[model samples]
Target: MIEIKNLKKVYNDVTVVDIPHLTIAKGESVGLVGNNGAGKTTLFRMILDLIRPESGEIRSNGEVVAGHENWKTYTASYLDEGFLIDYLTPEEYLYFVGGLHQQNRAQVDETLAALGDFFNGEILNRGKYIRDLSKGNQCKVGVASCLLQNPQLLMLDEPFANIDPSTQFRLKNMLKDANKSKGITTIVSSHDLNHITDVCDRILLMEKGVIIKDIATNSSTLSELEDYFGVGQTLGSVPVAGIDEEENH
Candidate 1:
């Protein structure tokens, strides 16, 4: 389980994330959704201890995540391209991450096999370095490496941002399988509300630096979510109030 209390983060004296309390249970898949600059990424970073929160505490399984001895073994996260090794091939990078977790080459191969066609043959024995791979392919490599460890807590930011539709579907299934079979606690952030609604057990909506809404999928419909997000259409045309015109331009 992951517990967060009075979490806060600031940059240049400006608050970015402020959550009073949150608890994510084991085997649960949660989605964090918000407009750009809503502090979703900041919150995820704090949970992974990649950044220090100005004040508050985060604990995983009753242990403080920042200083826990086994934190790296239990947690795996992929936040951005910086997490990948620029000089290593996809296959080589996976091996490197597995080695850090003390997984043998044979075990790493077995785990890769179980991921099936999620990589779409892009992460195989390619001789090219990770920097040479396309953005989508790089993302696939990062995701595959993280899952190689089969961590108890997994956090991913924009997991499907540049990936193709088929690969995205495969990733969704893989996450579902991990949650069901291993009871992994997963947190994902995405702009695609459909993906979040399809996979997550619960969803948190953020505005600015605060989470304004948290709803369980079992208790809500997609239409309800669209309404909450203020996304709608009028007479087959997207509503101006709901559209992010600036982003589109």
Candidate 2:
């Protein structure tokens, strides 16, 4: 569903993303795990065409993504609150997004209703603009908007960061269902190793702007990642947080 070739992005002569090649198949759930400055978000932004790569190219389906509009129709993403319209209420923002896909108000409401568990009653009818909500609540709104689009390819960056445990569980289930049942291809970048391993079928470990490992998830995948990050023995049962957040890319 997506492909990258010799992709590279740099700032101030420092290389941030240097992917030689990568492909994500349709209906596959792939996790991108990397420490800060590993270029996960930079890779995502290139895929979304939010920023042009200094070199190389990204393609969705068969078309190059750099100068294309077709991919947007089947793709949905949320990297941070910057993706949201801070002045708009949650309902208004969702409804506006639904309308872009030709869905009516009732359709948007139905989808929101189905997401009640994910929202945990913290979103919807809150009567406040998106900016007023807590970061966790804002994340819920962002993710809900993505689901509303019913995208074929979904990409989220650090989605597990601000949310609580219950919401995290709900999100895992939601992503799993979207991939297994709905056949939506997913690419998620996260620091929480346990959740990423649970939700993704494949894992890609990145370091210093390059993909260092691509492993299919199995019973021992989490431990393998822990070992690489040098925390397997010391952090038993605790989530392997990827090295500190990457400086804004």
Candidate 3:
């Protein structure tokens, strides 16, 4: 379980994230939805201890996250390409990540073989550095790497942003099956409402750093999200007319 209380972050005198209280139970799949600057990534950073919050605290499996390293044993996160080693080949990177979790090369190779369809023949043994791979392929590598250790808590930010349609569907199915069979506690942020709705059991709509709506995924969830983000309706905050006020002035 993950528990957050009174979490907060500030930059340039603006609150980027402020959550009074929240909890994610074990095996739950959650989707975070928001426009740019809604604090999705920021929140993830705080949870992973990549950034310090001004106040409050987060707990993972009854262990405090901040100033502690125990949670790292069970938590695996992939937020962006920055989380990957661009200088290494995809295979090398996977071995490195697996090593951190005590997974040997042979074990890592076995895991990669099972994900053949997800890789689509473009990732492993390509003999190209991750830096040279296309963004979509790099994303595939990153996503696959996160699943290598079979972490109990997995977090990915915008897993569908840069990928082919066929790969996207395959990835979604992979995540769904992982969640069902292993009951991995999963959290993902995405701008794609349909994809998010399809993979997650719960969705949180964030605006200006606060989750204003929490809806359980169902047949109507996609349309509901579309209506909320539709033009003329606020995506949480920021006056529409004032968008260009700073530039116009």
Alpha-carbon RMSD, each predicted model: 7.0, 6.0, 6.8
For all predicted structures, in order, the TM-scores are: 0.89, 0.92, 0.92
Model 1: which residue pairs collide? none
Q: lDDT for every model?
A: 0.81, 0.88, 0.86
lDDT of 1 at 175: 84
lDDT of 1 by residue, 44-98 (tens): 8888788889899998888898866667778888888899998988878888999
Residue 222 error for model 1, in Å? 1.9
Model 1 alpha-carbon drift over 4 Å, by segment: 231-249
Q: After superposition, how far is residue 161 of candidate 2 from its true place, in Å?
A: 0.4
Candidates ranked by TM-score: 2, 3, 1
Candidate 3 least-lDDT 10 residues = 239-248
Give the Cα error of residue 81 in candidate 1, in Å: 1.2
lDDT by residue for model 3 (1-249), tens:
898888899999999998877778899889999999999999999999999999999999998899998899888888989989999999889999999889999999999999999898999877999999998998988888889878999999998999999999998998898788889989999999999999999887889988776667777778778988886353333222101233222
Full ranking by lDDT: 2, 3, 1
lDDT of 2: 0.88
